[model samples]
Target chain A: MALKLYLDRMSQPSRAILTFCKVNGIEFEEVKIELAKLQNYSPEYAEVNPMKQVPAIVHGEFKLFESHAILIYLASAFSGVADHWYPADLQKRAKIHSVLDWHHSNLRRGSATYIFNTTIALAFGQPLNLEAAAEGEKILIASLAKIESFWLQDDGPFLLGNSQPSIADLSMACEVMQLEVVDTKDRDRILGPRKRILKWVEDTKNATAPYFEEIHSIIYPAKEKLQKLKTMAAKKEPQSTGEPA
Target chain B: MALKLYLDRMSQPSRAILTFCKVNGIEFEEVKIELAKLQNYSPEYAEVNPMKQVPAIVHGEFKLFESHAILIYLASAFSGVADHWYPADLQKRAKIHSVLDWHHSNLRRGSATYIFNTTIALAFGQPLNLEAAAEGEKILIASLAKIESFWLQDDGPFLLGNSQPSIADLSMACEVMQLEVVDTKDRDRILGPRKRILKWVEDTKNATAPYFEEIHSIIYPAKEKLQKLKTMAAKKEPQSTGEPA
Candidate 1:
C-alpha cells in the first residue's frame, strides 16, 4: 500500500506537505480533510489522527501528524528525495531543525493569528478583532525582520543560507503565502520592507516549481472571498446597539 | 574546545537541555544568560543567538538555538546518548518529532502563556492580564485533555507510550513544571484531573534522575516570590482608576 497523506489545501502546512511529496516524487495517496466543513472533527479522521488536524499520514500500520514531522519522514523514508532537503550532516540538519522549530512559535504563530483575526474570523461568524490583529502584526513584522536580517543574511537564497531549498524553506514560504488573504494594502505594508524575505519566498516558489503553485491555488479564492466580506462589513450602517456588524 | 551551552535555568527549555546533557554525560561548559537582566538582548549574546533566546549552543564554530533542535543535535551528534532518546528507525523518530512539534504550538503555548499571564507578567513589571490568563487556561485545559486521552493512552508511562523517555518527554515535562508558579488552587484545578499527565511527568523526572531535579530547583524560589506578589495584590484598596494594584 502507498503512503496515505491526509490534508486540506486551505491549510499552509498541508500545502507544504502536498508540494513536498510532489517535488520529491514520493508515492502517496491524498486524503482531503475539509476544515471549513468540520471534516477534521469526524470520528473516522480522529482514528487516523487523534489530534484531528490535517496533513497527517499513515503508512502500513504507522500513523503520524504535524507537517514538519511528515516532511522529515518523507525526506528520510523515501528513496529519491534530495539530500539537501534533510541532510545527514549533523550540523546542517541541526540548523534546518532550528529554523523549523522557530517557525512554529514565531513566524507561523504571527502569520496565522494575524490572518485569522483580520480576515478569516468573519467567515467563521466571528467579529474581526482589531486589537488582536494589531498585536499579531507586531509579531509578524518582528518575525519577518528576523528572517531578513538573520536567517537570510548569508549569500544563499534560502533560510540559514542554504543553496538548495530545505523543508524549512518550503514550510516557511508556504506560511508567508497565507498573507495573501489579508487586504492588499495591509499585506504589502507588512511584507514591503523585507526585501530578503520577498526574494527568498519567490526563490523557494520557483525552486519548487509548478507543484508549489498548484498546491496554493486554493488560497487565491479564499483571499477574494475575504476582501468581499471586508467591503460588505464596511458598508453596513451603525445601529443603536453599537455592535459590530 | 568544549561544547558551550548558553542557558538560563529560569527558562524551561533551557533546563530541559541542561538536564539532557547531564543525563547523557555530554561534556559541556554552561554559560548562563540571565533573561531577567536582559542578557539575551546583549549584542554579545546576539552574536551567539540572533533570536535572543536561551538554550542555545556553540559547538566549535557551529551555533544553534531552539531547545528541540538543540536536543535533536545532541542526541544524534553525541556518541554515548542512547538511541531511545531519538531512535534510528524512521517511524519512531518521526513520531518523536510529531510530539516535539506539537509541544510548541499546543502544550508549550498553553502552559507558558498561562503561567506568564498569571504570574510572570507581573514580575516583568506588567500588570496581570486576567483576560489573557483565562484564554490561556482554556487552551491549557484542552491540551492536557489531549495528552491524557491520546499521547499517554498506551500502557507505557511516558508520552507516546514509550517505555524509555525521549526528548519530547523531557521537554514537555519541563514545560509543565512552569505551572508550579501559578496559584496553588489554580494549578491544582488545572492539573489535578489529568492523572495520566501527572504520572507521566513524575516518570520522566525519575528517568532523568538527579539532573532533572537539580536543573528545576530555580522554579521553586520563583514560585514563592510570585505567591507573595499575589498575596500583596489582594490587600490593596480600591481606587478611582480601577487599575490592578
Candidate 2:
C-alpha cells in the first residue's frame, strides 16, 4: 500500500513535508485538511491525528505526527534518497536533530505567533493586538539572531555546514517564509535586518527548486485576500455594532 | 577525553540527559550551569551554547545543544547501551521521535508554565499571577489528558510498548514531575483527575530505578522550601510595602 499524508498547504510544516515527498519522489496520497474550513477538527481526520494538527503520515499501519518526525521517518525508511537530506553520519545527523528540536520552541513558535498576531488577525477582521504582536516581534528577532550567529555561522550555505540542504534547513526556511503574509512594514521590520538568514532561506529554496515553488503557490491568494481585507477595513464607515463586515 | 555535559540538575531536560548518561555509563564531566546564579549568561558559557540553555554536550570537539538532540547523539555514538532506550528499528525509532517532537510545545511548555507560575513565583517571593497560573493549569490538564488517552492507550507499559522505557518516557516523566513543587490543592486539581498518567509515571520511575530517584532528589528540598514560603506568607501581617516580603 502507498503511504498517506494528511496536510494543509497553508501550514509551514505541511509544506515542508509535501516538498520533501515531492523532491524525494516518494509516492503518497495528499489528503488536504483545510485549516480555513476547520476540516482538521472533523472526527475522521482527528482519528489520524488526535492533536488535530496538519502534516501527519500513515505508512502502512504506522501513523506518525510531527513534521520533523515524519521527515526523519521518510528519510530513514526509503532507500536511495540523497543522504544529505538527513545524513547517516552520526555527528551530522545529531546536529540536524539538534536544530529541529531547538526549532519548535524558538523559530517555529516566533514565526507562528508573528503571523497570527499580524496577518491572521487581520484576515479574520479582528482588531490587532499590538501588545501580543510586539512580544512576537521580540521573539522573532531573538530567534533570527540565534539562527544567524549559531546555526548558520558555518561557512557552508545550509545548516550544520552541509553542501546540500538537510531537513532542518527545509523546516526552518519554511518557517521564515511564513512571514510573507504580513504587510510590508511589519514584515520588513521583523525579517529585514537579518541578511544571512535571508540568503540562507533563498539558498534553501533554490536547493528544493520547483517543488518548493509549487507547494507554496497558495500563499499568493492568501496574501491577496489579506491585502484586500486591510484596504476594505480602512475605507469602511463606523458601524453601529462596531463590526467590520 | 571525556565528553563534557553542561547541565543544571533543576531543569527537566538536564535531568533527562544526566539520567541517560548515568544509566548508560557514558563517562561525562558534568559542567554545572547554575541557572539561578545567571551563570548561563556568562560570556564563557555562551560560547558553549549561544542560547545559554542547559543540557548541552561537547562530545570530542563537536558541541551540541538541546537535550533531545544530545540524547539521540549519545544513543547513536556510544555502544553497549540498551537499544530500547533509543531503538534502531526504523518504525520504533520514528515513533519515539514523534513523541519527543510533539512533547516540546505541548507537554513541556504546559508543565514548565504551571511550575513557574505556582512554585517558582512563590520561591522568589513574588505575587502569583493568578491569571497565568489558571491558563497554565488549563494547558497542563489538556496535555495530561492527551498523554493518557493517546500516547498511553497502547497495551504495553511504556510509551512505545517496549518492556523498557525510551528517552521519551524519561523526558515526559521529568516534565510532569515538575508539578511536585506546586501546593497540593493546585497540583491535585490539575493532576489528580488523571489516573493512567500517574501509573505510567510511576512505571517509568520504576523502570529507570535508582538513577531517576537519585537525580530527582533535589526536588524534595525545593518543594519543601516553596511550601514553607507559602505558609509564611499566609500567616504574616500585611506588609507596609504592599508585597509579600
Candidate 3:
C-alpha cells in the first residue's frame, strides 16, 4: 500500500512534510485534513492521528504523527532520500537532531503563537490578542537571532552550514514562512533585522525548489482573505460606535 | 576521553539524561550546570551548548543538546546501550521518535509550565501566575489522558507498549516528576485520577533502577524547601493584614 500523508498545506509543518516528499520523489497519497473546517476533529481523521494534528502518516498498518518524527522516518526508511537530510554519520545526525528538537519550544512555538494571535484567531471568530502576540514576537525574534548567530554562523547557506539542506532547514524555513500571513509590517520588522535568517530561508526554499514554492503558494491567498476580513471589521466598527448606548 | 555530560539534576531533562547514562553503564563525566545559580547563562556553559540548556553532552568534542537528541545519540553511538532503549527496526524506532517529539509540545510543555508557574516561579522571586498555571493544568490533563488512552493502550508497562523501557519512557517519566515539586494537593488532584500514568511512572522508575532514585532524590528536598517557604509566606500574611492601611 502507498504511504498515506494526512496534511493541510496551510499548516507550516504540513507544508514542510509535503515539500520533503516532493523533493525526494517519494510515492504517497495525500489526504487533506482541513484545519479551518475542523475536519481534524472528525472521527475518521482521529483514527489516523488521535492527536488530530496534521502531517501524520499511515504506512500500511503503522501510524505516526509529529512532523519531525515523520520526517526522520521518511528519511531513514526510504532509500531515495539523500543522506544530508538526515545523515548516517552519528555526529552529523546528532547535530541535526539538536536543531530539530530546539525548534519545538523555540521557533515553532513562537511562530505558531504569533500567527494564531494575529491572523488565524480572527478566522476562528476570536479577537486578536495583542499581549500574547507581543510575547510571541519576543521569542520569535530571539529565535531568529540564534539562527543567524549560531546555527548559520558558518559559511554555508543552509542551517548548520551544510551545502545541502536538511530536514532542520526545511522545518525552520516553513515555520518562518508563517510570518507571511501576518501584517506585512510585523513580518518585515521580525525578518528585516536578521539578514542571515532571511537568506537562509530563501536558500532552503531554493534547495527544495518548485515544490517548495508550489506548496507555500497557499499562504498568499489566505493572507489576502484575512486582510479583507480585517478591513471589513474595521469599517463595521464605526457603525457600532455610532449606535445608541 | 569520557563523554562529558553537562547537567543539573534539578532540571527534568537533565535528570533524564543522567539516569540514562547510569542505567546503560555508559561511561561519562558529570559536569553540573546549576540552573538556580543562573550558571546556564555563563559564557563557559554557552561554549558547551550555545542554547545554554542542561542535559547537553560533549562526546570527544562533538557537542549536542536537547535531551531527546542527546538520548537518541547516546543510544545509537554507544554499543553498551541496549537495543530496546532505541530499537534498530525502522518502524519501532519511528514510533519511539513520535512519542519523543509529541512529548515536547504537550507533556513537557504542560508539566514544565505548570511547575514553573506554581512552584519554581516563587524561587525566582516571582509571584505565582495563577492564570498561566490554570491553563497549563488543562493541557497537562489532556496530555495525560492521551498518554493513557493512546500510547499506553497496549498490554506493556511502558509507553508505546514495549515491555522494556525506551528513551520515550524515561524522558516523559522525568517530565512528570516535575509535578512532584508542586503542592501535594495540586499534584494529587492532577494525577490521582490517572491510574495508568501513576503506575507507568513507577514502572519506568523501577526499570531504570538505582540511578533513577539516586538522581531524582534531589526533587524531594527541593519540594520540602518550597513548601517551607510557602508556609512562612502564609504565616506572614496575617501580620500584614493587621497593619494599618
Candidate 4:
C-alpha cells in the first residue's frame, strides 16, 4: 500500500515533505487541509493527529506526525534517495539531528510567529502587537545568523556541505521560504546580512525545484491576508490582558 | 573512549538521556550544570550549543542536542541494545519518532512551566498565579492522557511491548516522573474526573518499578520551597504571580 500524507502547502513541513516525495519519485496520496480556516480542527483530522498540527502521515495501520520524522521516514523507506539526507555516519547524523532539533524552537518558532502575526492571526481575527513583533524579529534574526554562520557556511552550497540537499537543508529551506512569502523584498533584506546563508537558501530552492510549483499559488493569498492582519493588529494593542512579565 | 554527557538534571531531557545511558550500562561522564544558578547562560557553554539547552552530548567532539536525535544516534551508533529501542523496521521506528516529536511541544513546555512556576519562581521569589497553575495542570494531564491511552495500552507494557523498555518508554518516563516534583494532587478536580487516567498513571509507575529514584532528590527541594513560594504568591496576587505552573 502507498503512504498517505496529510498536508497544506502553506505549511513549511508539508511543502518540504511533498517536495521530497515528488523529487524522489516516491508514491503517496496527498490530502489537503485548509490551514487558514484551521480545517485541521475538524473531527476527521483529529483522529489522525491529536495535536491537530500539519505535516502528518498515515502509512498503512501506523500514523506519524512532525515533519522532521516524516522526512526521515520517506527518505529511508523510499527508493529514489541517497543516504546523505539522513546520514548513516553516527556523528554526522548527530549534527544533522542537532540542527533539526534546534531549528524547531529557534528558527521554526520565529518563522511561524512572524507569519502568524503577519498572516494567520488576521484570519483568526486575533490581535497582533508590534512590541511582540519586534521581539520575535530580534529572535528571528539571531537565529538566522546562527543557521548561516554555524551550520551552512562550513558545508559550502548546502547545509552539511552536501552539494546535495539533506533533510536539514530541505526542512529549513521550507521555513525560510515562509519569510519569502511574507514579502520577498523584506525577506531578502532580513537575509541580506548573512551572505553565505542568502546564497545557500537559493541553492536549496533550486535543488528542491518541485516545491516551487506546490508553493507559488499560496503566496499571494497569504500576503493579502497578512496585510489585513497588520491593520487588525494595530487595532489590538490595548486589549492584552497579560500581566506585565 | 567512554561517551560523555553534559547535562543539567533540572532539564527532563537530560535526565531521560542519563537514564537511558545508565539503563544500557553505557559508561560515560556526567558533567553537570546548575540551571537554577543560570550557569547555562555562560558564553562558553554557548560555544557548544548555540541555543544553550542541556542534555547535549560530546562524544569524542561530536557534540549533539535534541534528545530525540541523541536517542536515535545512540541507539543506531552503539548497536549494543535491542533493535526495538529504535527498530530497523520502519513502523516501529515511526511510532517512536511520532512520540518524540510529540514530546517536544508537549513535555518540554508543560514540564518546564510546572517546574519553573513552582521551583524557579520560588527560587527567584516570583509570584505564581492560580490561572497559570491550572494551565500547567491542564497541559500535564493532557500530555499524560495521550501517553496512557495512546502508547501504554494493553498489548504493550512498554511503548513497543518488549521484555525490556525501549528509548520511547525511557524518554516519556522521564517527563512523567516530573509529576512527582510538580504533581498537582488537586488537578483531578480541574481537568475533570479522569479516574481511568489517574489509575493508569499509577499502573504506569508500578510497571516501571523504580519510579521515585527517577524523580527524587532534585525536586525535593523544589517541593519544600513551594510553601514559601505560596506566600510569595499571595503577596504577588495583587500583581498576579506564584510558584511553578
Clashing pairs in 2: none
In the order shown, the candidates' DockQ scores are 0.91, 0.81, 0.80, 0.52
Model 2 chain A: ten consecutive residues of lowest lDDT:
A236-245
Q: Which segments of candidate 4 are over 4 A away from where they belong?
A: A129-135, A181-192, A213-217, A228-245, B42-47, B122-141, B159-164, B183-215, B225-245
- The sequence of per-residue lDDT tens digits that candidate 4 reaches over residues B126-167 is 555555555565777677666656655676456644444667
- For model 2, state the Cα shift of residue A46 in Å: 1.8
DockQ-derived CAPRI band for the predicted complex in model 2: high
Give TM-scores for every candidate, taking all chains together and pairing residue i with residue i.
0.94, 0.92, 0.95, 0.84
TM-score of chain A of each: 0.93, 0.91, 0.94, 0.88
Q: Name the candidate, 3 or 4, with the larger DockQ value.
A: 3
State the fraction of real interface contacts model 4 keeps. 0.59
Q: What tens digits encode model 3's per-residue C-alpha lDDT throughout B128-244?
A: 666677668888988999999999957799888899999999999999888899999999999999999999999988888888888899999999998887677667642221112
Question: In candidate 3 chain A, where is summed lDDT lowest over 10 consecutive residues?
Answer: A236-245
Writing each residue's lDDT as its tens digit, candidate 4 over A1-245 gives: 66899998878889889888887778889999878788999999999887788989988877888898888787777776887777777787777877787787778867676666544566666654444455467778888888766777564588756667788888888788777655566676787677787678778777767564556458677777677666666676653323353
**Could you give candidate 1's per-residue lDDT for residues A112-137 as a string of tens digits?**
88898888876766667776777678
Local error of candidate 3 at B241, Å?
19
lDDT of 2 by residue, A105-140 (tens): 888877887687666766545655555566567788
Worst 10 residues of 1 chain B by lDDT: B236-245
